[model samples]
Structure formats: C-alpha cells, structure tokens
Target: MSAATRAPRTCSIDAGSVLEQSDGSASGIGGTGHNAAIPSSGIGGTGHENTIPPGGIGGTEHNVAVQSSGIGGTGHDTAIPPGGIGGTGHENSIPPGGIGGTGHEPGVPPGGIGGTGIVAAGTLMNVSGIITAEDYTKKQLQLAKGDQICPGDTIATNQDAKVKIQFADGAILHLLKNTEISLVDYNYSPQQPELNRSLIILAKGDIRSISGKMSKLNPQKYSFKTPSSTIRVIGTDFLVTHLLQQEGALDAGTYTKVISGEVSVQSTTSTIRLRAGESSHVMLNGTQSIITSGGGTCSVH
Candidate 1:
C-alpha cells in the first residue's frame, strides 16, 4: 500500500452515482483495480476489501430504495422496494371508474346507466314501449312519464295505444295507432343548432321519425305539419301518415315515408324531392303524388 496510498489506475465520476452493497463488494483491496463502469444495472465494483451502500430510492415518500448491484449483496431481492419491475406491488390498478378497465362499459362513470336508457348526443332520454301524454292547457289532461311537452302541444294515442315522443336531440317519435300529433313548434338545442326548430302537426295518425341529434345539426330545421303540405327535414328516417283520403274530409292528406333521409314535399304550389326508399302523396285538393314503394300510407289496416 505504498506509492503514497495507491488509488488511481483511472477513476471517473461523471455524475450519476448509485453504489450498492450485497454482502460482498470490494472496491480496492491492497491494489490492482477493475470494477467501475456502472451504467445500467450491476452497480459499480472493484476491490478495497468491498463495501458500498448509499442508495435507497424507493417507496416514494422519499424513504428511497432503488438498488444497483455489484455482488452478493442485494437488498431484499436484488431490486425490491415496491415489488420489482416498475411496481407499486400491484401493476398500476386504478379501475372502478377513474377508468382503467371494467367500469361497466359505455364511456365509464358519468356516461352510462345512471339514467338507464339513452343519453349523450342521441338524447331521447326515456320513454319505454307503450306510452301516453296529453295535458291540454285548457281542459283535457292526462300525460305522465316525466311529462313536459310544451309549445302548443297535442299528442294522442288510443286503440292499441303506442306513443314514444322523446326529444332532447336524440330524437325518436314513434307515435302510431290513432295518433294525433301537433306540436306547432319545438325548439331543441343540442347545444344550439343555431336554435334548432321542429314543427310537427300530423293532425291525424302515424309518425315515425328518428332524426335527432337536433335533426342532424339543422336539417333545414325540420317541419312536417300536414293538413295538406309542408314536410322538410333533410337528415331523416321518416314516415308520416295522415289518411281519410276524403270520405270524411277532416284529414284528406299526408303520406310520406322516406325511411332514411331527405324530404321536401311542399304544396300550396309545388316542391318535391323525397329519396331513400321514397313515397309521397299530398292532396288536400292540391293533389300531387310521387311513388316508389306505393306511398306513405292510407293504411292496410
């Protein structure tokens, strides 16, 4: 151990130091060195009668426990602080809604099944199978199931009753069977479609629209009123049916069924274009007829 304390055959400490002790690590015993390239796991070593212990970076509370080895001296399983391989002991579990896995499908927490049926964009909130609603501002009254159909409303259904008029943008108005629709003006705002508007007034029976999301973001603002004309909507899935083709007179018109999208049927003059399966018929005396699959309906029933 002469030469003035022999300890330099080349030693460098560029910066990162992570020394470790595994019950056996000699740094420079009586001279002749060779153990110092500690770069990526195997923590620096080379004789001095061995002894290096300084790291414990683990368990985060800064109780530090991250090891780097050089020999027979690994702290509780070579690299064990929170349970090896980037572990906090249990493979990053977060689930249960904060989102990670089985939070029960659809958008996870805050997006599904609390309301039970349908929501988000297609917002026809609820209205199951058979339905009812009729509360005239002046006399008649009988409408339940979260009732609220303002704007000069009027919906009817009997004789095998069936009604489902949901709308908040997730549109769906299947009101068949002695139906009698009339909601002069409905303004849905799926966050504002420039102030969406839906003006329906079948005034007889049968309807079946599925154009919602605020009528596919402004489908010319929708309008189907028919004592004889006016059927707009451009992003659709429709089916209107007035009936009475005369005999009694009160109805005498309507019958449009496109089933997919696109409609225009005017009247009081003219304007026609109905695609997707097609079917039309006006006539409150204005006549007019266009067919593809016969015509919307005068009913086979």
Candidate 2:
C-alpha cells in the first residue's frame, strides 16, 4: 500500500464539556418571630406610667430595635447565625450525576469492564489497506486504520500480514500474520488511578506487546488471557503466540518469550515466572512448563 493511500489512525476522546452550575439554589431561612423585648411587669416604680411599644411586646418582622424602660431589660437580636447557608460553609457530597463519586469506590466496577466510564484504547494505524478488525461489543467487523478501537474489539489479520496499533496509553502492538486477539478490558483513567485496567486475550497466532503507562501503574492487573491460561506482565515488552492444533496431548499451544522486564504465565496446574532471555509454554492440559535451554530464541512471525 502506498503512503498516500494509507491514512493515519485517529483515536480521539472528547470529554463532554463539564457544564457546572455555579448558581445552585439555596433556600432562604428567616428567623422565627415573637420575642418579648421588655418584661410585662412593674417593680417599685416612681409613679411611672406604662407605655406600650409597637406590636405590644411582639417583635416586628425583618428587624426591630427595642430599648429597656429604665433598669434592666435585655434587647433581642434577629440575625441569621454565622456559618449558615446564607453565609459560606457547605461541602456538597452528591453532585448532579447521582452516580456521585470518583467511581473508584469498591464494588464500583471500573469502567474497563464496561461499567460506565468509557474511553477509546487506540486504533490500527498505517494499514496495508486490507486489515480488518471485529468489534465484539458493537458487533461490527468493518474496521481499518483511523477507526477507534474499544475494549471489546477482536482484530484479525491474514497470512503475510502485519498491523500496528497505538493505544491511548501510549502502548504499541506490532501484530504478525494469522493473528487473532481481543482487547478485553481497557480503561485508561490517567487522572483517576483506581479506575484503570488493561486486558488482552490471545486466541491464536503471534503478536508483540509493548507496555504502556496503564500497565506501569498496576502491572499485576494488566493481563493476557490465552487458550489454556493467563499471562501477567510487569510493564515489559514481550512476544506471545497461541497455536491452534487438533486435540492432542502434550502439545504446546501457547508460548511466551520475554524481551525485556518480566512476565508470569499461569495455568490451572502451575505458574512459571520468566525474565528477559527466558521462555515458557503451556500444553493442551493447561500445564505450564519452562522450556529447556536449547533452541532458545525469540521467533514469532
């Protein structure tokens, strides 16, 4: 494919403009009425005559000033207390979303699992003009370069084929021919650490993975599920391939070779950790075993 024909991938995330209502309504609370400004009695007075004030011992609304007759009658004040809503002292917990949270709370499923928060992972770029991707969630199979790839997208390539995908997390995937893989769970919340996860499933064929920031945040949480087991990476660049064969015993169906950092492959039977320059394989019965030190080389095409 010519460079002119192959278009660049465009994976974009448009966080809808956060429309915050600055002027939320606050109900006004007025002071309760009816306070005795002066006592309705008389002590030993010097021939004093009683004079009734306005409202007759009843305080006026809004505000009223009352003075004592002579000796000792307390005046009343009708003012809203300090730190009240009319003033400034309130931290609202529940926002308008009603979802009400950073969403990282436990039992608050991360958006990666398709809970609520949704973001595009990346897209296949610089295609040969013949690459195809199957989006499982959307149930669509017409995807090429420049199209956004979500979490549940399954991409496949034909013989002598090659593809490259740059993820939102800055990770890269260099896939080879006859490759079948799925982007299982991908939630890249760079600002929200707790709501971040990346998972990939390798059904068949070979591919190379380069770790992104998401993997570096929680490497143990980033995983690759294979035919018989799962592999967890430690922010590493590695190659993994799954081969399809007729039902047979002792046949290695999945292979993992680490180029940098480390990888841990676990089967139902056992688990093996591999470092750089190390390799391992999983058999048909979900048994993981390290390959002997012979014919040791990273070869996946």
Candidate 3:
C-alpha cells in the first residue's frame, strides 16, 4: 500500500495483556485482575501489585504495599500513614487543621489549657472613700468594694476612709479611718484545718476583728501584732487600736478591748489575759497594764 493510502492496522489484547500507546504509556492488568494505566507524564492506576514510577501520581488502592512519591495514595483500610500530609485518615500525623495527635496543643489560641491565674487571700467586702492597697513592690492599687486582697499587701485608707475585709475562712475585719494594716501571712485550707494560719499587723489604726476558723481550729497559729504587743485570740471578737504619740492627745500604745470570748496580750516583759468587756494597754516600752476601758477610742458596734 502507498504511504498515504494505507489502511490502519487494528489489534485486540486480552484482559491481562499489555497495551502500549504512542505517547510511551502502557495499560495492563495485575495478578488480581485489576487494571493499571501508566502515563508518560507519571500517573499510575490501582492494583494489588501495581508499580508506580518515582514521581508518579498514585491511585486509590486499598492495602497498598508501597506508597507513591506523588499525591493521593492511600494505605491499608484507607488510612494515610504517619508522614502523609493531608487526609481524614486515622493514622495521619499531619492533618490539615492542627499539628497535634488529638486536641490542639497547649497555649494554642481560642481555648487551650495552661495556667492557673490569680488567687485571693481576702476580698474587700465594703469600701468607702479612697481605699488603696500597697503591694510588696510599694505600687498602690486602688481598691473597690469587691476587690481581692493578697498576702504581703498593706491596706491603707485616706482620711475618713474605711474598708471591710472578708477572709477566705470567714473572718471579718473592719478597718476604720486612717488605718494601715498588713496581711503578713494568711493560709486557710478548709480540708486541712490543722494547717490553717493567720498573722496580721496593725501598723497604725483601729480594727475590729471577728475571729475565723483559723482562730477557732488552730488558735496557736493565729495572732495579731502591733509595735508594742502580740495579741492571740481564743475564738474572740475584739477591737485593737495602735496610736502613735501625738502632741497631747492619744498615748503611743497598743489597746485591746474584747467584746466577746477572750484575748491575751503579750508585751516584751509581761502577758495579760482579758475577757469580754475588759481592756488592756501595752506601752511602747513593753510595760503591760489592765485598763477599765478602751477609752472609747475604738467602737465595738
């Protein structure tokens, strides 16, 4: 036949036979009777023993013995193996959304678990005028009715200012005008009553205290201190006042008046116990004495 007038030759191959195309591509059937088509540009088909070229795109074959270098390959039970980049497969370590195995990593945005924030030793239950708290660093933070107070804080009030503090263990303290007090140490754990402790310093001012669980459960651990004396409670409600030496007015001493229960005031030289409606005075020179009254310097009501 002449070159341009020749009829095209046609041939037929069986199901398992190889068919080669002009573009250097081939199609065949594997031992399991699954068809495989390999193209010149490197695309592969599905079969049990299909061999994909180094840079070829693979098909969706179940239980694939080997993975392809190109994309879209699946493994046994349709699970992407450890290093697979993107899929909803169970074994896919690197998924599209997050990098972790299960939930988002710690400290991750919107909502991941990490830190325990601030803890309060007491709270200001009532406040009037300009009440402020000076922290350990001496930075003053303005206090409000519901502000939290921490240990090592010095709570001070301006002239005519007042504040009420409610401790974690149900103790109540009413700090009257021009008062300065420090929460030296306060540790209360209801589950462990034996460990309860409290220590407060009345720097200069008047305070009315209603003893709490710490004073009732561990009285030896609870105490109040002034420059002249240390006051220990016995499930008591008491008023304490520490006045500095002023011109000819109040004496420079620590005064204690018990409204209920009892309190023991101990100076450097002597210790004295007072019951309800009784009072005691401890001078800065460490002399202790009993007094008929607190001179109404502190109000019980």
Candidate 4:
C-alpha cells in the first residue's frame, strides 16, 4: 500500500485576523469568519481574487457587484443622472436644472416667484358717473366699484363724477368732479414698518385724503406732488385743489387745507407748515403764502 497523498494545507481565518495574499499583500479582515468586513481600499484574498459571495463583500448585503468608490456599498447606487440631486433619491441636495438652492421653483422667471411688477396700490370703493383710470401705456379703463388701482395709474373723473379710493395701508381718498390724480409710487408692509412709503400726484383736481398707517408711522415718507408744490403730511386729513390758468375759474396754483393733524407744503423756494384748520397757497412762481380765513373748504362734495 502506498502512502496517502498529502492534501495541500489550508489555513482558516478567524475574527480580526490578517489575510495574506500570495502576492505578499496583506489586509485586516475584521468580524467573525466569512462575515468579515471588506475594507474600502480593496478586498483581501489569495491572488486578490473576489471569492466573497454576492453582496457579501460589504456589510450591506443588498449592495452586490459594487465598486469600492461607488455609493453602492452604502446601499445607494452611484448612477445619479443630471437634475437628480433634488430628486427623490437626494431630497436635501440642490438640483442642477432647478432652483432648489435659491428657494425658487423650476423654470421661474428672472424676477423670482410671483414677481415684483405692477400691483394694486388701492381700490375703488365707490364710483359715480364716468370714472376712468389711464395706465402708463395710455390704455384707459373705466373704473367701477371695487376696481383695483395700481401704481403708475392716472385716475380721472368726468364732469359731475365722483369716486372714493381706499389704499392698501388704510388711507382714504375722495375725488371731486373733473379731478385727476396719479398714483406715482406706494409701498407698504405691516411686518416691515421702515419700508413704508407713498407718493401721489394731484395733477388738476379737488381731493380729500385721510392719513393711513404709512403716514402715521413714517410721516416723512408720504408725499403728494403738484405742479406748484409738494405736500407732506403728519398723520393728517387734508384737502388739495390744483387748477390751471386755462380753467378760467380758479387761480393757477396749488391750494392745501389741513382739516386735522398737520402738513408741510414746500415749493421751489418756500416751505410752510399748516396745522388743523389752517390753509396755504402755493403759486406757480414756487412761492408759498398763508391763506386768511375763508380760503378753501375741505369738503369733497
């Protein structure tokens, strides 16, 4: 009988044992037996062969046939396409084609969401006769009750017409017949009181105005402009009358009367402050003078 051929000696690796390859390379394989964790650098075995079962290389058994640099070892695929950052796979990352980083939606215009374009500055609360509003483009729109009045709009009332406007900041305006006024600019934010501002142009007309939150909070930021003077308020209810020489009825000047509170009327060369029950006249020459009793009435009727 011949001596039994000796089988090749094979060594079994235990937990936390070093695995040496035939090429003299060595790596630490931790954990128990075949469940040892595979290093991110490379797999360890004889001849560097991938002898580990499918999905057994990494601790995540679902990641099969994944490369070392791929996210597959972490249970996620590394094949993310364009615009995939904000997609379902990566909810916290920004997408390439969307504005996730800027708090905007995809395909939004340059001005941002909702935009800051023309917006309603006031609304027509009551309208009588023929009242119209002209925009910057010269487009005229007949106004009715509850009609929106935007900035850059010139509102006019025909003969015997009357209209009342309620501003966003709680101001009130009453326009008499044959009156015209333009809303130049208006900005109001209850949350940001410092940003409140307003400007109205009394071109030719009789108008009564009651101060609102914008004027009450920041009186210096609210103003009304006419051809002859600029009127600023201090939480006041006032009346303004502007007439041209061609009208042939009233003087071609700007007249202001303070019914309540106070106001400052400024011309090119003069400035005057008027309290309740006071009145002033601003001539075309940019001169201001106090009006005696019976100068003008504050009634919009």
Among the numbered candidates, top lDDT falls to: 3
Question: Quick one: RMSD of model 1?
Answer: 28.9
Lowest-scoring 10 consecutive residues by lDDT in candidate 4? 108-117
Ranking by lDDT: 3, 4, 2, 1
Q: What is candidate 3's TM-score against the reference?
A: 0.58
Which runs of model 4 end up more than 4 angstroms from their true locations? 1-117, 246-249, 293-301
What C-alpha lDDT values do all the predictions have? 0.45, 0.51, 0.56, 0.55
Q: Model 4, range 180-229, lDDT digits (tens) per residue?
A: 99886565656545546688999998999998898988788789999999
lDDT (tens digit, per residue) of candidate 2 on 124-201: 675553456655324444456676676556787788677888888788888888888888656565665444567788
Q: Please provide, for model 1 over 102-212, each residue's C-alpha lDDT reduced to its tens digit, 9 standing for 90 to 100.
A: 112222211111111111111122443434433222324344344445433466776676656567566787876777876644544444355455677887878888776
Work out the TM-score per prediction.
0.26, 0.59, 0.58, 0.59
* Candidate structures ordered by TM-score, highest first: 4, 2, 3, 1
Q: Tell me the TM-score of model 2.
A: 0.59
lDDT of 1 at 195: 45
Tens digit per residue, CA lDDT, model 3, 173-287: 9999988999865656565555466788999989999988888888997899999999999998999999877526657899899999888888888888888898988888988
Q: RMSDs, each prediction? A: 28.9, 22.2, 29.5, 29.0
